[model samples]
Target chain A: MTQSVAMTINGRRREDHVEPRLLLVHYLREVAGLTGTHIACDTSQCGACTVLIDGEAVKSCSVFTVQANGRQVTTIEGLAEDGVLHPVQQAFWNEHGLQCGFCTPGFIMAAAYLLKQNPSPTDEEIERGLEGNLCRCTGYENIRKAVRSASQAMNGTAAEPSAQLVGSAAAPVED
Target chain B: MITAPFEYARPGSVDETQSLLNKYGSDAKVIAGGQSLIPLMRLRLSQPTALIDIQGIPGLNEVRRDNGSVEIGALVRHVDIQRNAMLRESLPILVEMSNDVGDNQVRNLGTIGGVIAHGDAAGDYNAAALMLDAEIITNKRRHQARDFYRDIFTTALEHDEVVTAVRFPVSTGRFAYTKFRRRLYDWAIAGVAVQETGSSWRVGYVNLATTPRRGSAVEAALAGGASAADAAAQSGSDIDPTSDVRATAEYKRHLTQVLTVRTLQKATMAA
Candidate 1:
């Protein structure tokens, strides 16, 4: 009942002997220890378990681990690189897009996939694109703002990051 | 919840797949996109002893146009169908209908063959396929779309038969599909599809019955020169729908008429 599956996760190759019944969501969270991909509804109704399978977003909860054998999977944990956040993640942080933070990873992953498909989407297009990923805490206005900001950031219009020395005497006080 | 334990095999060829099917018989289920099957399995509605994954089979995912028809391979995903340039130019109704399927995530993995074989009554592609007079090509033989469905979630597919592709004749006339649902991603409570077949219109209703229902009375009224409103009013005359949790039989019937009128008007304007 167990099958050997070989897949590249978040850019690294992984091999696991998983049950044929093991869902991709569980596989990503448990075996790979990529707990960033949350499983809120276990069911496919919620996009909390969304991930990029071969660069296309799909519901990992609905996909079996065996079905993803020899494929590439990118989880939410894979979004940041070299201690820097992905543009989508940075947008979410800068715009105060998330209230609960439970749905942020899934939303960021979904937004990443959406912006890839549409670089400069209209307001209606952004609504239709992220309709699959639900945010119960935030009424989606801030999430929509984050997605638009991320789109602008990814298009190279945003200002570059500035490096500032820490612990300086003139440093601003923390909130 | 996890799926029931099952043996898994990914056959690389159609013949190999058929042999596995013949060996496992009805205890085995063929999984293409696994969009519908995986959900049912997780819900325990289906617990097959063996799952034959056909997604690895080669050459079953291509969309080619031949003669006067467009031949779509069984593994053609909904997103591919919607984005296919050839299909968009030759038959855009299929693309339009594909756009209304499950959300972007679902469409990325859900395939035409998977949807057709699952044959849910409320499925968006069922009535569209029926209206287009599509032909389902299986490894064993070909099946007309009209003869494909037997009942709710049932199809004419044999245990060992594998659906290879579907052939749809190129349609040059107008077509429109309207699906009524409570939410954006929910399945249709009732749907109306209008496709011009030669000199007459073919109207098909979804979720109005246990099987895909042809609005024969509506089509006939239209052929007799009745207005769209009158023809749409006749939509409830030809089909038998049940009162399910989704809607009352009366409500479904009412939706059928109203959606039929809206769909007919859209199709007519396109024509």
Candidate 2:
């Protein structure tokens, strides 16, 4: 049995009859044909399927398609403007954020959300903000740099992150 | 990565949700945020045949002041709590704790009622709620935080019941939540939540036992003018620490004591 769900994906109204158990990540890839949202861990750990639902970053794999029925979803494929890249994507490209590129889309989406939330995050804040998304390539230095660069591009001034948000950033990032 | 095939219903009201739960019985599960349940479902650890999504239930997403307590709706997301000006002003510890939850993405979807319902020992909110003497209000009746937790991953909630809101006594008191974890987004290995209600102190431990345990012995020690170190030395009085993948029993005991000192110092010194 399938449930009819209609949601706006990347500003385009999409309607589909999806199984009740289908994950949002699978719906985006299989049904919507937007494979830019990768699913590396499939579990919620890797954040490889991260996307913006209603302008907030969420792990697509953890949300059922029916749950997002009336929401707006913005995947990595929906980030770029006509013939131009989003600031985070451009910063990732400029700073060489990924080596294998498998985790880049997730990183970009996570970074996009982070910049939107804290447009002037410090290095430690960036690290804490993107901890959900992992890079098996161990290219975190560049990823952090890419986020730092993204903040500069979007806000035009990279002031220090607010003192309140500066928490447990000194804490470990181990698995 | 998909949950087991299930029937889905997005009920617009709690009454409709209760009816769906009655129709599905034990096979039905209430999904508020689905952060914890969906992950388990993807791993096939939990395979509920029916999902009762309570997101469409309106008026359950706000943190409002009612009488002498603050009422946080069951559908209030962690992200909302973290960024909520009301909670940040009245219950700053919750904002701090909410910020340290799984991650930004997890916070964006996870809800306080869901966390309380899931009852993961490592989750941050259970200890906070217990330490604050919060009340768990369900569709059926009000349950005290002390009796709501049965065990790890277990709560007093019935299959046909759903949490409607959590009532925390209005407090701008000094409090601190310190979670010890190996990773930024990882669950707490052992954490402490200390909140001051009037002249007394309530201390709660996270992941120290099968349930969130409050340390009355530590509180008594504090009341008796025991030093921070001495009060924290009584941490083992109320809770039992176990050897887990995070740390050994002895290490968790020691860490709990040390963390208790830090948590206490943070709580008292704040005001």
Candidate 3:
């Protein structure tokens, strides 16, 4: 009743025997032990379970594990390189985009895909792009600011390191 | 909620997929994007004994123009249709419809063929295919979009047939698709699509009935030079709206006319 699946998650090859009905989110959380991809909503309505499948942001909860065979998945844990943070993750810290931080990982991953699609999204475009994810804490203003700041950082227009130093996340932030 | 256990197979060719379908018959479900099917399976709303995963099938994901038709492969995902430069140029309204489908995550995994095959009334592309006079091409034959729907979540597709592609005639006129949703991303409570094909007009209604309904009377009135508001008033001629959790029956009819007028006005403005 189980299917063998081979996929690359966060740059590591993983092979597992999973049920045909086992969702990718369950496999990522229970089997792979990468729990950063939260399941805020089991239904695909919320993007809290979003991850990159072959560089496209998709709701992991809706995707079956066997469907991801031979594909590369990038979760929230994959955002950092060695000891440095991804620009979007750094921007979240700089902008204080989280309160309880439960939805932060999903927001960062969704924003990463947003920036990849539109590196310099306008304020309105950012809202439209991230409509899939919801932050129940009403931290949308900070989330929007974080995404905008991430766009600047990724596009190399971020404020000087002194301003970035104000953030708790340390610098030489890039790998 | 977890889905009931089922046997799964990924077939690489349409012929092989058809064979699997023949074996499984009504017990097997062909899964492409799995956006709708997976959700249904998880809720146990539908429990098929077998699943023929057709994602591995090749050649059903390309969008091309051939012999006066814009042929979109069935496996073409919504996001790709929304972003396809060729489609954006030749069949822009289809692209616009895809943009309004669901959230980005849903669009990433949902395929056009799956949506057309699933045949949800509230789905945007259903109305688009009808309004644009697209053809639903299957492994066996071609079907006019006008005769595609049977009822709610029902279509003209046979149990063993697979939708290989949809061919749309190149649009030569302006269009406006107006839909009203309760939430920012909810399914359309009521929607109206008006397309002016240069020589004639086509109007299709969404969620106004058991299936995607064509505003034939409204189109007729418009062709006879009726004003947009007057033509939109004819939208309710054939549709007997039903009350659902989204809106009251009267409210849905009201929205149909209101959105019809809005879409017609928008299309006129574009003209």
Candidate 4:
């Protein structure tokens, strides 16, 4: 029950024979071997498996790999170019946005998509835009700050995020 | 959670899609955005033997005006409807309803035709379609909004019938949709949709019964010169709603009245 699927992932074409039932999250993590996309919930309630399909944010776990055939996908791993962090990735780093880091990829991808559509989003717009991504730690205060910072960077208005903003990680790594 | 194994088909045409439906019969399911069906499949609530992906079908995603109505192809995603300037100008209620559908990701990939075809009682589009008096166009023929929905999660679409588009008469009056949910992205416990046509109001309720309910009694009351509160007070009398995890039957009935009033007032204000 496997079909040949060919699509561009992380700006590179990837082809594989996969099951029709294989979720896109598994395709990105297993077949494509990009593990930054985490799967926290199989029910699609959690946004941990979010990614960009044709430049729009979507829940990869809810999308079948076969459904994404011949489409372009951008995972969290695809955000950075060469050795430099994407503005979103750097904002999360400098703003102490990651709590456990398990949900970091999903948050970053959602925020990136948000900024793509609204480069100068208001706080309410940011809250509404990123409401799909949940953060059990940081109470989403720092995550909201990170998205604001990223918006400023994407809009080319802000200098480097202040070093003082990176006071402490939101939550300790469980491992 | 992985879905049960199923054969897949990407039909390029409506005839091909219907033929695939005929080939697979009742065992096959046609998927548009896969927003609702995919989650159900992953949870094993729906396990079709074959999935016919209709995203590749040609000319099934256009949103254009025809005659005096706006025709929306089945593959028109929520975001598409939400962002279309023409639709925004002509049918802002639809845009408002689409905006309230789900979070950003859901709206991006979820199709208008898919949700309408799903016929979920709590789905926002059903109430919109009901209030708008939309025409559900399928491969076979057009089904009137009042005749399209059979029950909760049921529609007039046969196993092999493919919904091609929906036609909504161009609206030229105030419209509003209000949903009451536990969270921003959750399904509505009870929702209200109000649309004005000429001198009368067309009202509909979501999740208040097995099918999306029209506020016939409320519409009658409004037509009889009743105030918004008085019209909305008749809301609970027109439909039946059951208790669920979201709320008690009494609470849903209460919400039905309150949301109906709020939507009517908002719609009036917009007028």
Candidate 5:
């Protein structure tokens, strides 16, 4: 059976007819065409489908679209405003957080919510906060660094950019 | 992946939910937070014809102290339980167990009632509840912790029965829970929860069998004034755990002893 549900996604109010069995991940990826939320595992073990609901991070795959009626959802695409990447996104890019990039968006979204709740998370806190997310490519060393860097960046300390720290200058050499 | 087609009802009250359950009978499934049931539905492990969404039900999401026990509403999410000061002070074991369940996202969306009612042997809440001697309160009746589980994925819940709350005695003693899992948020290969009530200690084992069960022999030995190591040796005397992809029964038995010793030491330190 299909039911009409209304929700606010990425700052826009949306109303649609959805099947009672449609998962929120499918609704976000297909119906809403916000494909940044990826489904890495059918089981709830993988955190690849993480999204922000009412400013708290949750696994979209585990939720039904009907249950999200009148709720606020923030996807990866909604992180940036006015062409500027959110601090966590920028940190991930600068810290070399992603090698394959499949898990970056979910990690970024989860970290963004974590930082909101805990601005100065210890290494152990970061480990526990991001325990739901799994990344096979980078082995999580870079991801942890990225989260710490993002936490600093969000606090506006203005540390050295990731590219310069890694000895890769963006400007072309004059010959 | 698509879930099987099903009728859905968002009941506003417990009476409405009970009536829906009575109407649908065996064909209906009660969903609190949809943390566990939704995954099962999508996997076709459970194909209920109708879903009675109880998320909006009143009086089912509270955590309050009543009659010297902590009454946790069935719909109380794990996140709420972890943060509840009363629960933290009264039953810190539950708070510790909640912190280790799945992860932050799962804890935010998962409900205590859903976890216990699902009756997965590997579930951390089951072990914690069993160790604390929690009462599983339902719409029809209340079941004691020892009598709650029938087998893996099976409980004492009647066809139309709905769990409204769980009640655990406020503990002044120390308690600790230790789970060994391959990865964070994964089900335990084997885990142990040890609680010291006054001078007596009780131990509960998880993932050591088809249902969470107490290490009665260890508890007996402890009550008999046995040393922690001596009591830990009897950890697997009451369980017949299966060898699965996670670990061998022998390995789990060994982990039972190891975890029991460690947990008891931790509980003692807390005491």
Candidate 6:
């Protein structure tokens, strides 16, 4: 049987009739049409389906839509506000954190939540914070840099964007 | 992946949850956070006909100090336990174990009671609970932490029972946890938790057998005044480990020895 579940998503209250078995990732992608949250691995091993539920990061695929009723969910699409990129998204762009971009949104959401909780995370904290997310292409040096840059940017000291732009551009050109 | 069709009920109170469980019996599964069970459902490994969603129940998500023990509600999320000041101060072993449980997302979604009740041998919570000598309080019966685990994926919980809270006695001792894993989020091939009391040490081992078991041989050797390194060598002597994709039995035995010694030394130094 389908159950009616309601939640506040990105400042908007939404209601949908979902199967008790419907995963929160599918609900966000299909019912809410928020495709910014990608599902890279169907298993819980991949953090590509990460989102902020009640201001905490959680694996959307591991949660049922019905279980999320009455909660606040913020996907990668909701990270930005007022036509400006969130500090995490901007940091990823500034640090060249994405390769194929499949894992960017999840990393951005996870990093945003991490920075919100820890505005000045150390390199070890950043590594532990992003341990769940897997990037097959970028080799993680840029992701780690992006997380540090995002932490700094959130603390009002933004990094130089041009250096990473050159690096990102040069890598694809070399390929 | 679609989960098997199941009925759903969101209970508002623990009494209501107990009644639902009594009604549905084994056909129903109690879902709190759904980090482990949902994945199992998606794989069709568990096909319960109904799920009693207890996340809405009040008074079941608190971590409070009572008398001489810290009481943790069954619905308390791992992240909450990890950040709880009292739990961190009183039972940091639990906090450290919670930190190693999956990653941030999994910890945020997984509940301590769910992890313990799920009873996976590789689960981090089982080792911590065993090491801390916590008590698993259920609606039907209360069990000592050591008596709660019966086997892999099996607990002392009755078909109609639900874990309400867990109580861990406060101690001024030192503890340490060491696990050997291939990746950050992967399960440990073998792990050890050491708790040093006034003059004795309690050792627990994980992923070395079908259930979380005390390293009785090591504990006995330590109690007999053997050196920590020599005692730790007997870590897997009393238990049978299985070979899985993660590691062979011989490798797991070796890891148990190494991790046991390291954990014991760390706990001793902390003491």
Off by over 4 Å in 4: A160-175
Lowest lDDT sum, 10 consecutive residues, model 4 chain A, at: A166-175
- In candidate 1, what are the lDDT values of residues B1-271, reduced to their tens digit? 8888999999999999999998988889999989899989988999999999999888999998889899999999999998999998777888988988888899999999998889887777777778778999999999999899899898999999889999998876788989888877888888888888789998888888888878889989999999999998888786788887888999888888888889888987876
Ranked by DockQ, the better of candidates 1 and 2 is 1
**Model 1 spans > 4 angstroms off:** A159-175
User: Model 4 residue A47 lDDT?
Assistant: 86
Off by over 4 Å in 5: A160-175
lDDT by residue for model 5 (A54-159), tens? 8888999999998888799999989877656777877777778888888878898999989998999999999999998988784599899989998887786656
Candidate 3 has which clashing residue pairs, if any? none
lDDT of 3 by residue, B23-100 (tens): 987889999989999989989999998899999888999999977789999999989998899888788778878887
Listed in order, each prediction's TM-score against the native is 0.95, 0.94, 0.96, 0.96, 0.94, 0.95
Candidate 3 residues lying further than 4 Å off, grouped into runs, are: A162-175
lDDT of 1 at A153: 83
Candidate 2, B197: how far from true, in Å?
Answer: 1.7
**Model 5 TM-score, all chains together:** 0.94
- Per-residue accuracy of model 6 over B54-103 as CA lDDT, tens digit each: 88888889888978889899999988988898888888888888888889
- Which candidate, 1 or 4, has the higher lDDT? 4
Whole-structure CA lDDT of model 2: 0.87
Clashing residue pairs for model 1 = none
Better of 5 and 6 by DockQ: 6
Clashes of each: 0, 0, 0, 0, 0, 0
DockQ of 6: 0.78
| DockQ (CA atoms), all models | 0.78, 0.69, 0.77, 0.78, 0.72, 0.78
What is model 2's DockQ versus the real complex?
0.69
- The deviation in Å at residue A58 for candidate 4 is 0.5
Per-model interface RMSD values are 0.9, 0.9, 0.9, 0.9, 1.0, 0.9
